[model samples]
Target: MLKKEAHYQEHHFLSSDYSKLMKDPQIDDAWQSDIDSLSPYLERLTMREQRWLIGHAIHDQPPHNIAAKYGVSTETVKGWRKNAIKKLRNM
Candidate 1:
């Protein structure tokens, strides 16, 4: 499902292989450092925000299904998810 793919992509981004790919001492050091620096910020998200992010990543569920789980309107769920990601990016 689309949601599953999204989840996989997120996990891939956080995986060791991805980290190792950034291991070039000269060229990739800065990139690697940047990802490392973001760890603390990522860790600071609220639990609900984190779950929503993971759900979004999986991309399996339609907005309506996600809304049902969260007891919100589909539009509201979409908005919350979008805002959550925007906040994460800003962090």
Candidate 2:
């Protein structure tokens, strides 16, 4: 019944690729590079957008869950996500 993407579980920071990258002690520069590239776009998101992104990507939470957390609806969460992505993209 989920309309969302089928790849939520693999999108997290602890997913295989990212975890393997983290395990490399010699990859601090790689980590820093990632941080530098992502920090600005992440900072551009509103707090609510940030929370939704974290809940979805990091915590693997669904739109319904996040909507309930904010006393909104699934569509609202989707709207927020749309705006968030637009802001990041336009940046």
Candidate 3:
């Protein structure tokens, strides 16, 4: 189980650039549509994972910053983001 989880996290992560689209300050109809689509998937993740995802992905926060907020290491924050994406893909 541990090995599989590690493999999944390592292999399924997307570039931070993918989340940059949502980092824009503009709020438009298309942005609403995107959020609507993303909501269900994001809701399925653990609270910690969701927080990490939103911070790192949607908000374009650095991993270290997220880690500091969560009282975890930067790598742990990255793991949360990657695992959250893996769960989204598997769903």
* Model 2 lDDT tens row, 40-69: 555656555655665576457899998987
Q: Candidate 2, which ten residues in sequence have the lowest lDDT sum?
A: 6-15
Better of 1 and 2 by lDDT: 2
Per residue, candidate 3 scores C-alpha lDDT tens digits across 1-91 of: 7999977764553435335434545536654565656666765666567667667655578999989977999989888888888898898
Q: What is the Cα-based lDDT of residue 71 in candidate 3? A: 94
Candidate 2: residue 41 Cα off by (Å): 2.9
Q: Per-residue lDDT for 2-91 in model 1, tens only?
A: 999977654434535334433534334534455465545445444444445534553356777777876878887677677677877786
The local distance difference test score of model 1 is 0.56
The backbone clash count of each candidate, in order, is 8, 0, 0
Span of ten consecutive residues with least summed lDDT in model 3: 13-22
What are the RMSDs of all candidates, in order? 12.2, 13.6, 10.0
In candidate 1, the residue pairs with backbone N, CA or C atoms under 3 Å apart (3 or more residues apart, or in different chains) clash, namely 2-59, 3-58, 3-59, 3-60, 4-58, 6-57, 7-57, 7-58
In model 1, what lDDT does residue 50 have?
A: 44
Candidate 2 lDDT (Cα, whole model)?
Answer: 0.61
Which one wins on lDDT? 3
Q: List TM-scores for all candidates, in order.
A: 0.43, 0.52, 0.56
Clash pairs (backbone) in predicted model 2: none
